[model samples]
Target: MYYQCVKLRQIIIAVYLSISLDGVADSSGPYLASGIKIGEVDQTSAIVWVRLTHEKRAHFDKLPILTKGLKRNEKDAESMPEGVARGMAGEVRVGYVATNEKRAFAWTDWTQVLAENDFTHQFKLADLKSGASYSCIVQVREVGSDKLSSTTNGSFKTAPKKTQPVPIRFIVTTCQSVRSIDSGAQGHVAYKTMLELDPHFFVHTGDILYYDKAPLCKNIKQARAKWNLIFAYEHNMNFHRQVSSYFMKDDHDTLKNDCWPGQTYGDLTFDQGLKIFREQVPMGKKTYRTIRWGKHVQIWLTEHRDFRTSNRVEDGPEKTILGMEQKAWLMRTMKQSDATHKFLIVPGPIVGPDKRGKNDNHSNKGFSNEGQQLRNFLAKQKNTYVICGDRHWQYCSKDPQTGVLEMGCGPVNDQHMFGGAPKADKTYHRFFGKKGGFLAVTVVDGKAKAEWMSADVKGNTGKPEIRYTELLGSR
Candidate 1:
């Protein structure tokens, strides 16, 4: 009887805190705490992701490190740090206009951000002009109320028309672990240095965050908190606010290390992990896609975790990674493309001297059957190249047998560099770097050339040193 009475009192207090003295639902101002992400951009459309929070910025307090072997009892054992971005229920609307154009703003109806989706909403803006820069503003308000909360501004550049001969510059990076972050609240120095080059867009090839690492996330709530904690940093939020990006998922971000379709990380299922990824970022119906950036470049962004055979499965003809449908689409698209250069941006290496005994990606001996088949096709194509992520170190390699070229974009910071070749393998690697860095590619249509630069990350204020540069294709 005493326990029942206490439970009732707790419930009464919760209701009182949620409601006002006037008995109205408490509708307070919602702020843009996570900033905004613009992705899946093309000539005619782009998706803008937004989230409403209870505070102006994410809490900056640090979470306590977990004790060893205590995986499932984190919530009970230790309190979560205040550094998380607390989501709130609210409505969001977007308005956009082409940059430098004296035109009326195009607006969308207010859409509510729900708790089930981590208080996030993605607005798809269509009919945008090709090769044009767009200025966007997002407005937030309380649910069931007309009063405005605040407005945040962002910008992105649309891909040029298919036939237009335009030059393009973009950055590709991978394997950024929050635990490996060198800077505190400032986030990764790679973000600031990449921004300095003024890329048209950025591609995070995968391993955006480490879910299975220490302070393990074993459930949906904990997983969601992980996203809030990583993106809350000033550098991450500021970079995404300005640059349009393409986000991919690998084993770590999806669920666990080397995860497949049917696997589960604790109570978190594979399907739930997929849903969380889509909810957190701006994406379209299809995860695998090819976006054309004028006549010079066409980039194929492949999905790694969504469709694949189990890593534990025996290696054979039936052992596959890209799956049948995606493989078919990739082959068909490559055949029909007339672009000067074609880039297959994958979450893992295709021609890697990856650390031995690691059997997950195409680089491993386990997947050699399928890997060789894909490598053979790429070698025959005109000026085609594979730009990959997932490796901690950076390298440029050419398959000895197939003659196909590949560039591995290294980790975001120096602390994350590991498992790289101790000495450059003269047989495969034309260039290799054990330090942290990113890949910057420039495609010049008029000159009919592409420049690849592998840069080494210095400190936050220090300039990134260009370690290597290569002229790709017929220059």
Candidate 2:
């Protein structure tokens, strides 16, 4: 009797182990790479992006089996299980409609099959009405199946017509260190606060993710994996899902610190990094483009990496930062735009003096001539603002020469590297804080107001204590 009982116990343990292993496999199975994200909303169109995983499996019982009496390749007989069709990709459907209420959505009929294994898909919905709120939905159906495997919903408000005066608000942020996740920190309070504010959209100046620091990613695969890991965080996913994002890449996220084109870092080429960036971040075909938020704001998203001369090059009249073509495009765009607020977005501060000296790449000091050229051009414009990130600290300053307001948005979750030592110079340096937070800008009737909030090391954000209000002339 004792021997029989021990044998039965061993069988039960084996069965339990088998069930546990199966559960683990199921938990780690393929899933949506990231939740749906709304990117780049304009007066008439918006872009939606998502990634889905493809899997292949065969089940004979699930498919129709051939009869034993049937011969191979018989004309009148049904195909065998071996010849049964199975889906190898997923079908993505995106729908949107005008909505006055958030929950009461009316979906349109827009669907497409994801035939390629690219792992990323982008859909552009055009012909949308201006100054209207839209409710959008994204659904993924596995190939050969009629049921949707995953679904997510989001909403965006299109820019008003050119002559319309609409109140506009947006959050500007940068620099989320991957180390924050590794340290097992609590909820991202800064992100939570931004979500609570619920601005029209959010502009990510740059340094969206770090690859050169701890837990670094060396290759394309590793970089993609890092994106997945970061987005998997509950707060991060929730923020992207609910808010429209305009993303730009900086030194660390593109390749390494102070990186430019033509610099290769161990299996990570500029093109490869750019490809991954475009795939992951939903932006226009060109890295640099202009976004018009009605007649209130005209934002120029510049590309600092591509077409830039190496930072090591000597600063002179010929040393170009914006490159010839981009500079011309920017000038043309700025000169033609009649918006109340013209925001020039860069990855780093263009007017401040860096701690390292006057020639560091972080600030525009290194490219003095090009920087001066930009300043001269801005001097002619009206209410032109330069918004930047990468300083890991917040500052509200103005270019002494051109009087253009320069606002440096602090880091989102990383440590403030600058110790707030270099005092304010001749330039307009109003406030500087070494805290992790973001900038909230509100534009109404051609006037703009900016508030800088502080986020503690623990990620808890305080109210907007530092404020900069300016009267940007009439539209």
Candidate 3:
């Protein structure tokens, strides 16, 4: 949606001019990866990221140094050369590690760390002057000549330094299929509409990349088709050459749906599967980490399937989800937060189905078992809320015991609908039945007014298929 006010018009114009020149994916130039992405701008830092076009970075590294001696375009020197080539690499090379050294935020101090376990690359920049609007880009190296070819470039504004609620946005997505996007009805149009929202942040609840090794979605070919859904978008000629994007990987994003340590989809061993993920997405290495927006909101994002021992917990105390290290990290972070609101990016279920009975869901790591532990532990702490996705509809209800609100959002584009969802006009908030949708949340004056917005009708554009919003007052 590229929403910007008159005041931001200059920034937009400037960013586009730089990008148009550097991002030329279709015509043999350096290029940026595409599809759903995320960027974080803070008062002192800004993080920009994107997936790569291949498994390695060969000649890309050489392109940059070769062009170093050449006089850069003076008007937009930082963006000139690089912006002109994004997503234009006709062939794959060494592990995609190319990054632009000039442009808006060229000197803003960026890090390009590969998520060795997956196809994601995370660029975390720190010490950015607070409140300053800056630009950024990626460049490829022309081996041995010191010549550099520029690709991706765009502008972003950092959050304020004040200890108050600040604007933070990024796009979030998961569960994309390759075949559907290319040949299906909506196709790339989905992203076209989402970008209009211009959210402050994006949080994809896993499935960022899927190969469908589990046959969970039905068939092997279908699984391959699913991978095409999201990966194909990021690889699209138009998107890579033009649009900017960020990506994160999940089970499906890595292999098959609801996949984990218990199974392997195809030829990918856990390590090999991680490499595939590392090759395609742009994500920080830390699977579980904290993103703080001012001193008001704290987001604890984690990957549940990555470091678990099968899905079953055997009370051996040795079994873990985040692993001992990540678990301790989460616990420590939770106890240390002083934000007005704490958001846990729980990718799976929280109030899961019971497991003790005959119809019990087995395993220690099962949603009902692990999820319950997490929920109860948080309840013991000061104050926090739970919001998750995976199910295709939206459900909002409060924990009868602690009076905390639990919200569910999902299936932005789905093949099914909810059946007999508990209907609650007001308090018992529930929206849609077998549909595709997303979530919209706004935190104002310490109170967050959020909703499950979906597109009940296929023809709907830019707006949700359906929407239901509720307030979760600040703790």
Candidate 4:
């Protein structure tokens, strides 16, 4: 039976052997290696990204911008993933909105990367000025010395100008890998349901991208070909969502398995790994950022991988998951937030007391002191929400020290049973079977209430299960 299945899959993918364009079956158009996507929406700007077909030496008039070490005689295989965007090599432009003032640093125009390196780019709205909605788009140029280009655009509604407290809303989802959705996890269904609820925006908990488990393909090119197939699944699932979505990456999608900062490239794998990842994912830099919705909410995006010292096999100063600066940034953000509601988003479940602090079933207790410290700090804030993802399950809780509510989303694309709940507060409750669903958040009169809706296990795609609801903060 297994062999039969394998044979069937091969037959199903025979045509994939042919390089495709934009992940379609058409023979025309340039082949694409992967596709990055837009991340969270802010009142000011949003993020955008893409991937290329080849990665090594693109013949844009035969000029290579990143051919730092490759010999001229090397074949296309010698180039990295980003270098593979065009024919043998290529690059990409990550488009984003940034004003000369407020939070962004550059002007609005075409940004390009040379084929010699990786065709990857990231722009921050560090100076994205506060005002009306800002529209953003990225034009992907084929790095031929001639500059061939294609464009994809998206828009984000910036925060409204308000001096005093105001009501706010946003939805949260997680574990949304193409793998899970393909398996009929219904997470996307949950997301659509949440969107129907019409909140202010969307927040992705974590594991936005999954990498550890390779898709059903062999070789770098085939694997990347499968990864690029997500655009199709998204389109078929009608995954075209317009709400603002905040995103953070997990091990599979971001750096790599248990990846930490200062970790040197392991082998040629990482060389191609990083290049492909950069070209394919527009997660933005792994850093800390803050956004305020009126005077009632201040949300913080935490960076967990980039600058961390190391991981916890036992424990060491190198045991930083968020690094000293990010920790400090988190602390400061919490201390300074005057919003009635303050949200802290982590790449991993920040509230669970997992002993290993690894997956969802693990208790949040056995975790690091880092999260505990944040919990202790937020203990003072009556209105706080600590949300997390990567567990591949759904959970909800409230801090005993701080009546603040925290919710866990995902394995959205996967499946996992309920483990248990932390006993921090009467508000700390646990619910299950939401593995393939999303959270709908609503705010009215300065009060925020959240609902956890579980999607019907694919067989019942027409309907979903509303597991439960919880209120996190009230102004």
What tens-digit string does per-residue lDDT give for candidate 3 at 29-134?
2233332232434456544444433322222222232122221121111211221112322211211111222333334222232323122344566666554455
After superposition, candidate 1 runs with Cα above 4 Å error: 1-28, 64-83, 418-422, 446-462
- Please, what is the whole-model Cα lDDT of each candidate in the order they appear? 0.78, 0.66, 0.46, 0.49
- Residue 50 of model 4 has an lDDT of 40
Q: Which candidate, 2 or 3, would have the higher lDDT against the true structure?
A: 2
Candidate No. with top lDDT: 1
In model 3, what lDDT does residue 394 have? 59
Put down candidate 2 lDDT per residue, 52-133, tens digits, no spaces.
Answer: 6433211212212111111223223221222111222566767677654444444444344442324667788888888876
Q: Write the residue-wise lDDT of candidate 4 on 1-475 in tens digits.
A: 3235323433422322232114232222233333335554455555554444443212222213122212223332222232223432333443343322255424444455544433334554544555344444444444443344343444444565445455566666765443344333222445544534434556765555444432322235533543444432333122322345565655555435666544432232434544554454445554467777776667787766556544544443345567677778777767866676777776676555432335311123323455566666767766777777666566786555545456775555333323322333333455544354666666667777777766433345544456677766552
State the TM-score for model 4.
0.66
What TM-score against the true fold does each predicted structure earn?
0.88, 0.79, 0.68, 0.66
RMSD of each: 11.1, 16.3, 11.4, 11.9
Model 3: what TM-score?
0.68
Lowest-sum lDDT 10-residue window in model 2: 63-72
lDDT head-to-head 1 vs 2, winner: 1
Residue-level error in angstroms, candidate 3, position 154: 2.5
